[model samples]
Target: MRSRIIFFVALIAILVGGYGIYDSVLKNKDKSSVVVNEIAPQPKKDSVEYITVWRTLNNIDRGESIANDALKREQMLLTDALDEGLRSDVELDFSPSTLFNRDLPQGALILPEYITRENDPGYIDLLVTEGMTLYPLVVSNKNLISDFIRPGERIDILTVSSPSSNLSGAIEKPIRFKGVTATLFLQNIKVLNMGGEDSEQKLKPVAGKSEDGFTTIIIEIPPTEVARLALAQRTMHLEVYRSREYEEPVYADVRNVMSNYIGIEEMRGSKNKNGREGEL
Candidate 1:
């Protein structure tokens, strides 16, 4: 009975061991399959693209700081976004006043002041530096008073008594006369027929230039005459009258003057009553 029991126990042990080995093999196969399925492929990354943009500054007032106020904030933002991929240049335009504010057209830049050859062209570093005003006078086609008026030169402007009359009429029937001294831009006022040998009544403009094609004159008149001059400019043709005596005179020799004089020979012969056939 003991020998049969021992044999049966031995057989059961062998069967149990074989089943454990098979289960272990299955588990290992399952783990290998899961490891293959769980592996993730590397994700594709997109390449970053960069672009260039152009900009300009305009209407900056005179004496204003450009570095801090003009370019500080904008420059930081642009540089940050561009990350060394952007570049820029500055242009300055000067004028008398600020009236118009328009965005620069594509690929164009307008400056707040005139950048002369003397100004440094490197990157701007200061904020309290002086700048020129970007006014319409710089770009406009119209003439301005600064173009015509000069220093120390005298000018005449006819003042109008009535508000309706123009400058020409005011000069003809001058309600008043204003005498002004020309300053920097005196030549801007057209000096027409300045040294002509014609009478004042027949004085007409033979040649002239204006501040911007508009005739201007500087003469010694009274403050009250400004109105008439304004009226003449608006209504009739204004004439500029200049005295030859007051201006630099051109002297001619007596022989030259007598060359054109008629009957001068007769007068010379009469003076020589001796009739000695003198070389008159």
Candidate 2:
């Protein structure tokens, strides 16, 4: 009877151990068969903010007038363009006289600081208007009041020459007078520049030659009058007289060589060139 009891207990212990191993196997199989659906993160989209700015299409030099075709428009991020001092299409001045103040490489952004207007100090060619020609009138430094005259001022040009008359028409015999006569050559002319004032030495006297030093007064004139002005400048002495804006040109002539005197004689004993007493 004891032996039967021992065998029955052994069988029960074996069945229990086998059942535990089977249960573990079933749990592992169930865990392995289950599927895990994972969701991945997506990338962020770009910002919708942007701005339109001007850019150069080719290399531009300093003091050069920028043409419309030489520039290009592009859309850029507002945050990036604002810090660069760039100009937009509408904000830029497209006048014919507008010029670049600094050299710009190809594909460079067009900035406001690089621009120069008519009032800026630089070369004056960019300041000339369309359909007008720039002519340089060379005058002696002693004759011109350069301190009073400035660019953009209006002035009348006077020519002083000895009067001449044709005695014989066929022979073209001319008789010239000793006294000099002055006449208005050009009136209400616009002064574009006073040359040789630039610190960079880019602007020099228009006529490279002068006897007692000279200053080139650049003026704007019509194409029709260029020939006359050029001829007069070469043949006679030119003088400048400041005039008002929109002032009608007046016919003026100066023939007197000396001022009428009402003065006293010198107190000291001084001999004049003509062997007479010197008078003041």
lDDT, candidate 1, residue 263?
Answer: 57
Off by over 4 Å in 2: 1-125, 165-180, 197-211, 245-249, 252-280
lDDT of 1 by residue, 152-239 (tens): 2333322222333343322244332222112121112222212223334113332234333432222323345446444444554333
- Assess candidate 1 and give its TM-score to the true structure: 0.26
What's model 2's lDDT at 15? Answer: 100
Q: What tens-digit string does per-residue lDDT give for candidate 2 at 179-269?
A: 4466687888987667655533322323323346767788899899999988777666677778654455444332243332111222425
- Model 1: runs farther than 4 Å from truth? 37-182, 185-212, 215-280
- Against the true structure, whose TM-score is highest? 2
Superposed by TM-score, candidate 2 places the C-alpha of residue 70 at a distance from the truth, in angstroms, of 26
